[model samples]
Target: MSALPAVIDGRDKRKNPMNIFAQIRELITTTLDTMVQDGTLPDGLNFDPITAEPPRDAAHGDMATNAAMVLAKPAGMKPRDIADALAAKLTSDARITSAEVAGPGFLNLRLAPSVWQAVAKTVLDEGTAFGRGTVGNGLKVNVEYVSANPTGPLHVGHTRGAVFGDALASLLDFAGFDVTREYYINDGGAQVDVLARSVYLRYQEAHGQEVAFPDGTYPGDYLIEVGEALKAKVGDDYLDKGEQYWLEDVRTFATEKMMDLIRSDLKALGVEMDVFYSEKSLYGTGLIEAALKDLKDKGLIYEGVLEPPKGKKPEDWEPREQTLFRSTDHGDDVDRPVMKSDGGWTYFAPDIAYHYDKVQRGFDLLIDVFGADHGGYVKRMKAAVSALSDGKVPLDIKLTQLVKLFKNGEPFKMSKRAGTFVTLRDVVDQVGPDVTRFVMLTRKNDAMLDFDFDKVLEQSRENPVFYVQYAHARVASVLRKAADAGIATDDATLAAADLSLLDHDSELLLLRKLAEWPRLVETAARTNEPHRVAFYLYELAGDFHGLWNKGNEVTSLRFIQEGDPATSQAKIALARATAIVIAAGLGILGVNPAEEMR
Candidate 1:
């Protein structure tokens, strides 16, 4: 990787050089500054609201700016008056071929063909780094995901959160953030006790004793191996021991074994965590006490009685005095109890301590990826972080909706291997990791996604993963064909090609689409959504494929000219640049770009 260029005023100077939209925005701002100095506009007017982006209607122009409309009221002038003045000033630049005012005040500008040609050249120069951005500005971010209890293998619900969180982490890292991927092992909860009992039953069965798994115990066949392993280690030492004699030891052994199973499942899907913080570690340590004490110091902790929850029957409702955190002060709907009347910590207490740990680690931002069932936990968690950090650090929680599995156009059944739910391994094994990852992100994280086993594997345009991968494979084919013809297709040679030969509208449209990549990356990173990358890649692939189909009708639009290697190299450069961006976007999504259809 090349070293990033110098930083100016906390913004990377390279951002403008690689992004044409940013460059044009810079030119618009400079023109506005000149207008201010020339007394055409007021000296103190703010220009931050002005924007330069692609026109909604491509027929209007190549790019559009709302400079005239945004500045009209501030400059105390009519929009058309400002528009005409701005247009005249903008047309003076070499890159701006024409600037026309439309509607009330929008300034639609067409760029010189060389401007689009230069974008293709820049793509060849930067390779995958073309859209890499510094929007994050090196902020430290901690992303916690897949913190499911160590009871069994990760299920499909956990699978969606895992893929979303991992891709978001990679996306943030690509956007220049210092990111830490973490998982919180829920080992201190009652569920682990149930797992211990379940494994004990399996252990008894392993010892040739018939045992029945009660309703509270996990009956998954996945635990049978753990039971056999436990029996092999103990060798009938605790064969008929009482619950007190073996519960603690068996709990420890079972939790570790389940975590190993979870780790293997995650590895099969290509996920690795930087830290696995245990909930058990927060106990018997001063961490929990210290976190609550900080809240007490801030006057956000008190002994109080909360009103009975709404929709509760009067006969079943009781108000008990508890040690509660003043969550309502930080935007929660109500105060939340940290310690119950019996002096035992509630589930919320440990969570507050966990987030407190993240804040103490000096993370500038904290994000939690959770299943949709945890939606109610969002407000209280954010309230805890706000009180803990004194409003210094920010917390964002993303809830991934359920993933419904389909096969042959019907709902898929549960996996017997997992007993009641489908395991992550079950999904990954059916379609492979690349398809699983890409299809998981085809929708917004909060929206319901249907993962159809048959549809995802299809080779049609309806399958987004296949469409995008096919676009990449097509570009690879173009390069091989160019190589067979004895053409120099290296990046250096392509960058030095006579790019003016790429003046066709179809080629320019593709270049314009490529120019939006850096801007798209920054927007997606700011919103912490990696699915936008998936949507953009699909659209880009469509544009590339559309151009390829157009080539069959218009012989001049083909990537390979009959005997004109100069024009051929210019066209191939555009194709290669498109592939470079597709690979970069897929890389962010943790999907490998396909080199061939098979």
Candidate 2:
């Protein structure tokens, strides 16, 4: 069986598609297997990392496999010797045109240019289905993200996690995984109580009573309407009542209102979640207790005093004994408290139950997208999942680094007097979802992103998002022009368009970049990091843009071959293929591809 990464999907969405590159991988591995049978590579060797990656430079080849380098030590030969033998063998294959050894034993394989033309035709034939490569089979996965507290509307920080998670889920779906998008409600915490008090102040104001906003009580006027609505619903039923009489009802009412606001906030940003699990549900019903009991039964829980954390210990640093989980056994620093001294569950309690519920739901994998602020939470959460699932489930927690906002090189400080912060709607409204999503993904999950208000909106080539989108739009415009000029835009015509006419080195390099799409998708999906998709799209767009500019110098390279419909159709097919890949990538990012730039 070929190795496949697991993907998560929900009730909707198609599972991952096994792409052309994966087929190539299987073929290459089969070739190796045959070699082993015929006494070429030694039998006892690990080939897990034997990858077929595109070279950074296209002049190197269409595709380069590390098989030569990997088998060098095992085959007891010099890297070059192994590469030479491998090249000689691969050159015999029908798909390979030329195989040459480069560098210190790197085997570069150049396929027939017909191979690239066929790729374009394949993409046209498949449409959106072209790049749906499955490194991930239908394994159940839960992607938890943007579980921002329902205290207010989502801020700019939540926007990054929201876009990252939504795009990631889309990418995984295309890569063939059963995925569930979940949001864990934080309504069970002290934050919710604060929300209630804030709403009460609003309710009192609605009753024509003067109210002063207190510290820690949410001062965002967002909850004022919720408070007014509450007053209209209950008619001061709990008016002047103590906390015992109204706290629960207010919290329930306020949280529902907050969640409604949050849902609308997500809708404004084009994000949707499959499930919204309430952290409050984990308490009182013995769910958190049951999760803890399960761990305790497995000897992973106990009562103990934890040493103060490495940094400054709390001023209240009495190491009073508390109920602790033996997280160290599962790879955590010391033990972690499941319950506080006051007989209340720690914040980690429901989190454990939440993950346990996910594992219990039969998901094969779990992914959590958290902000960089929660970087310290990674190990403990991993430890909990490890202990709860008994190692059956693998959890990958991605920490989205901070997004620094800048307006023309000045740090864009969020206006404190304006409100709690900027919402996802602000960014989407200003830049549109495509730019917002693409810009957020330009950096890796762990690296900080500088979101410049002015720069991303600039239509220059330096702005990666616009540059990529422009390439797609430019290609689309050329295709439209070709059709208007009576050029056949059908796949069959383009497929037979004397692709042999594409002999220029510039055209060949573009074709090679096109070939890398399938491989790039499979790799990005395998790593479960959609940022790779963003990078690949930028690079592909870069190649396309360079080729487009080349047309100014080389008249024949222009996509619109004047007076020749067939040749124009052939040239336009490459442009169409470029748009198709960009659209595919934008689809994964949950961003819409423009047919033309407006």
Candidate 3:
């Protein structure tokens, strides 16, 4: 492939220069503009639908664009006519070695080898910042995830939400958003009362009194220490007290202790929240009232009777006049009740107030990472945010599906320490934080994931975490080998090497993959899908491994050339660029890039 001119006239200055796809797309758009200016195409033709991406088949070309197909009708010209004209204009640019119109107006373009070579140099120059984007434009986003009730240690389901939320927050931050990692402590409900009662039983056990855990109480051994600590703090002062005498105080103390356990569980999984807002804080604080007032002022709140839930039997259903929010007006399926006829707030009332608090805090966007069981809650939460924010701010709710764990080809049993379910600590302790985090994100948040313990730990390509990490480790090995051979292997030395020597197709293929990093970051960030980052890394690792395997047959494709320092440096530059991108992707996924495989 031949190199095009480094400077193309009318290129969009806003596009990232290092993103090969963006650069080429800019060139195409600018060329289209020229077409319009020269009266070759209609002036009012819209170019928004035009896209330049890699072709589905690698044999086709380096990049493909649908400019001709998308603009043909609007330009009042045949697709081939526009394709022919566009191809001629695109080839005129020196960077494009060839532009072929294929399959009825699709334009396939190939860039010079130097364009791919420059991608390596850019990656070395930018390091971890190579794929960072400015698309967020510094918008404030609050990501509330793992807001599990502070009643016990987080379970496997909460584990998925924690990892997904943390990685998504990191991805958004990498994409230039001012992100706040938050957890809402669910402490303002009857669950805390249950927690208090559970701890009271354990407290009696600590006082050398045998107590039975009731069906509604937590039966986990993880709460034993909390009870012992409570005994140490209050002695026997409340040993024989009535429920009302110690219920509120014990509830507050137990919730804090469980929150501490939750925090430790999160830390074990490498998640740390920027904020931990409390649900109890909204009660008796006028915050809930203020939020409802905001909706009422907008004429969204009224006392009305809701239809009995459709699936409920007549005897089980009761229609009552209650204070309700006109949620349907804001896209919810039905108006939601804010308060009962007896003047008690419903569960959703506090949630609405919580999000209203987020909206009032000046966030440009809000994201809630909830377990899949909360799927039914999505629409109402969105409606609340839409109504509360007056449609100025957008809310994106991501529901993480269940993670079914298996050990030795059998379903993993519940943790003995947690009593009824597997806790986050159990998962992290068994596989380690890095493995836990990476494996949790292997699937989309909304899809069910089967986390086979034996499979995930296997050192095989089927294990994506190991596969990606091994690629990074392989690059590290190459750097070590280059160093032992007395070759200059630092990024600056390799970047300044004679990169023109990297003319092999395998090397160029790796470079092409590196060039997609920035584009991938932007696309994944725009869609709020951090799992896409994990997917891209796996694909990138496969490409790197393919090139590595090719080196075994074709000696010239090896990352190091014996006695040829210049060629070795050029090839090493490619390897180092691959590592840089893998590390950057892992950073976004909250996984540490392994320097050497164990």
Clashes of 3: 4
**TM of each candidate vs. truth:** 0.96, 0.93, 0.96
lDDT of 1 by residue, 1-598 (tens): 1112122123332354567888998898888899889989898887767778899899999899988898888778999999899899999999999999999889999999999899888899999988888777788889999999999989899999999999999998888789999999999889999999999999999999999977788998888999999999998988888999999999999999999999999898898999999999999998999999999999999999998878766885688999999999999999999998999999999999999999999998899999999999999999999999998788889899999999899997675444668889988999999999999999999999999999999999999999999999999999999999989899999999999998888888898999899888877877788999999999999999999999999999999997999999999999999999999999999899999998
- Model 3, residue 464: distance off in Å is 0.8
lDDT of 3 by residue, 327-349 (tens): 99988998998897789999999
Under the 3 Å rule for N, CA and C atoms, how many clashes does model 2 have?
Answer: 10
TM-score of 1: 0.96
- The pairs that clash in candidate 2 are 7-177, 8-177, 8-178, 8-179, 9-178, 9-179, 15-176, 16-175, 16-176, 17-134
Off by over 4 Å in 2: 1-49, 415-420, 491-497
Q: After superposition, how far is residue 193 of candidate 2 from its true place, in Å?
A: 1.1
RMSD of each: 3.5, 3.7, 4.6
The TM-score of candidate 3 is 0.96
Every candidate's lDDT? 0.90, 0.81, 0.89
Which scores better on TM-score, 1 or 2? 1
